[model samples]
Target chain A: MPRDEFERLDSTWASVTPPAARRMLIAAAAAFSARGYHGTTTRDIAAEAGMSPAAVYIHYRSKEELLFQISRIGHATSLSLLTAVTGDDPVARLASAVRVFASWHAEYRTTARVVQYELSALTPEHLAEVAELRRGIEGAVREMVEAGVAAGAFDVPDVRGATLAVLSLCIDVARWFQPDRGRTPAEIGDLYADLVLRMVGAKAP
Target chain B: MPRDEFERLDSTWASVTPPAARRMLIAAAAAFSARGYHGTTTRDIAAEAGMSPAAVYIHYRSKEELLFQISRIGHATSLSLLTAVTGDDPVARLASAVRVFASWHAEYRTTARVVQYELSALTPEHLAEVAELRRGIEGAVREMVEAGVAAGAFDVPDVRGATLAVLSLCIDVARWFQPDRGRTPAEIGDLYADLVLRMVGAKAP
Candidate 1:
C-alpha cells in the first residue's frame, strides 16, 4: 500500500504485459473456438494475428499455454461476476448472478466455447487450475442456493444437482446461440433466469 | 413385390454398399467423434479402417459426405429412441423419452459429441438435412409437451422455452460426463429425467 511498493508492483505488471502476446492470445482464442485445439496450429494462430510463428513462441511456450490463458481469464471473469452479485436476499442475489453469468457467456461466447470444448487439450496441471476455478464459481452459486434453502426462500431437493442444471443451461447457450437468432442475448438471459428460478423453487419477487 | 423388382432393388442397394465404403464410414464416424471433424483427416480415417486413402475415395466422394452419413445415422438413432417410447400417459411417455435420450447420449457420447459439436463443419446442404432431422426430433418432443399441456399433466409457462431447456440439459451431458466421475450414465440419465419431470410440474408415477 506504500507509494514506492505500489510503483514497483505497477512496473512489474507493465514489464510482463506484452501487447503482441495479447493479440496472439485473442487470435488463438478465436481459432480454437472455431476449430478444436487439436485442429489448430501455432502457424494458424500466427497467421490470424499477423505475426510470424516464431513470434508466437516468444509470447507463449506452447499452444496449450495460450489456451490456458484464455480459459483462465474466462473462469476468473465468471468468478468475479459471481462474487460481485452478493446481497442480503439470496433469491434476488441468485437471480442477478444468473443473469450476469448468462449475459457474460452470451456476450463472450467465443471464449466460453473454447474453454468448454477444448479443455481436454490442456496439460494435467493446467487442467487442474481451470477445474479449480470452475469449482470456485460453482461454490459461489452453491452457497447462495444453500442460503436460500436455509432461509426458506427456495425448496430444491439437491443443491448440487440444481447448481449443475442451472450452470448447464447457461454454458450450453454458447453452442446454440447465434447473433441472428430471434432472441436478443438479454431476452435469452431473462428467460433462462426465470427457468433457473423455477428450477430452484424460488418464489417470484 | 415381384421377383424382377426385388432383384432390381437389391442390385441398386448393392451398388451403393461397397465393403470398403462401409468400413470407411465406420472409421470416419469414430475418427470424427474422437478427434473432432476438423481435427481428423481422410488419411486418419483410412488408416483406422486399414485401407488406403484412395480406397476411401472410391466409396465416399469426400470427407463432407462421410460426415453427412454419420450425422444422419446419429439423428435417426436419436429420433427412433424418442418414437419408441410412446405411451398412453403423456407424463410417463415424456419421462421415458427423456430417459432414453439421456441414456443414448451417455452411452454413445462420442458420436453424439461429434454430431452436436462439429455441426458447423457440414456443408450448407448437409447442414440443412441434419437440421431437418433435428427439427423432427424437436417436433416430437414439442408435440408430447403440447399433449401434456392439453391433458393438464404439465404446468410449464413456455412450451418452446421448456422444450429447449430440457433438450439443452440432455445434450450437454456429453460435455462434462466422465465415467470416473462417480455418476454412471444410467444414474445421470435418471437424475436428469427426474429433474426435467419436476421442472414440467409432472407428478411422479
Candidate 2:
C-alpha cells in the first residue's frame, strides 16, 4: 500500500548537518524547481534562505555545487530506497521497487526535478559524481528485472530496453506530477507497479 | 522495419516561413538543447544563425518568443504525426502510434528537448496554446488505448493509468536519447511498440 502523506520538504535534507546549510540547500532546490539552474543565482538562493549571498558562498563553492549536493543526496536516497526492498519473489520485489521509486519522485518532486532535469548544468566533475549514483539506481532496477526473467516469473525479450522504459516512466513523475491534480504519489506508484509488471509480462500479482 | 536514417533537424520546422526566421528558430533550438532556455541569450541565437541581435527581433519579439515558436511547432508536428497513423486494427494502430511517437522524440531530439523539457519557460499565453496541442497528444494515445480495450484486444485494468504510462514512456525518450549510443530511434520505436503492446496486454503483433 502507498503512504497517505507527502514527505516534508526538509525531510530529505535532514542529514545535512548545520541547520543554516540545510536551509540554503532547501532554498536552492525550491528556486531551481521554479526557475531553471541558469535562471537561478546564488543571491536568489541566499535570499530565499534568508541569508546573505556571501553566506551561500561560505556553505557551497557555487550554485552548481548546491545543485550537485541536491542531486547527489536525492539520487542516493532513491537508490537506497530501491535497494532496500525486502522480498525473495522477483515479481513482488520488482513491484515494490517501482512503488517506492515512482512515489519518491512524486513525494520529493521539488528535489527530483532538480536532480533529474538539471544534469547538463552540473560541471563535469559534479555530473560524474551524480552519474555514479544514477548507474547504481539503473543497476538496481536491471538486476530485479533480470532476476524475474531468470526465475521465469517474467517474459522479456529485451531486458535492457524494458529496464529503460521502467526507469523512464518513474523518473518522469517529477516533470508532470501535480499535487492537486491526477492520482496521489502512492496511487501513481500502485498504478505504475501494475503497468510495469504487465510490461515485463509478469502475471497479475 | 525501422528507418535507415534519422530525421533531418530542420524537417520538422520546414513549414515555418521566411528562411531567415526558420534559421533563427533552428539556432534557438540547438542553443536551448545544449545550454537550456534560461542559459541562452538572443546574442547567442543571432551568433548561431550568423545574424545580428536586431535581426532576431525582426523575426521574434524576445528570447521567450523564439522558445514559443520552437515549442509550438514541435508539439503540433508530433500531434499530427501521431494522429496520422493508418490502420483499422487497434493493436496495430496503437503499436504504430507508439513507434512513430517514440522515434520522433529521438529523431528530432533537439526540438523534442525544448518541447518536452522547456515547457515551464513558455509564457502563459504561449503555454495555453501549446497545452491545447498537448491535450490532443494525450487524447490521441488515450483513444488508441480505449480502442484496444473495447475490441477485447487489450486487458488494461486502468485505461487512464495505462495511457499515462505509455505516453510517459515515449515522451521520456527525449530526456535520455543519444545518437552515438544505444539503439537508433527507429529501433527504439520497434522495441517500444512491442513493450507498449505488452503494457496494454495485447498479443504480439
RMSD for each of the candidates: 8.3, 3.4
Q: How does model 1 fare in lDDT?
A: 0.79
Over B16-64, each residue of candidate 1 has an lDDT whose tens digit, in order, gives: 3676676676677678766778889999999988999888888789998
In model 1, the clashing pairs are none
Residue pairs clashing, model 2: none
Full-model lDDT, candidate 2: 0.86
Error of 2 at B155 (Å): 1.2
Model 2, range A69-174, lDDT digits (tens) per residue? 9889989999899989968899999999999999988877777877877898889998899899999999999999999999999999999999999999999988
The alpha-carbon deviation from the true structure for residue B184 of candidate 2, after best TM-score superposition, in angstroms, is 1.0
Interface RMSD, all candidates in order, equals 1.5, 1.3
DockQ of 2: 0.65
TM-score of each: 0.88, 0.94
Name the weakest run of 10 consecutive residues (lDDT summed) in model 1 chain A.
A1-10
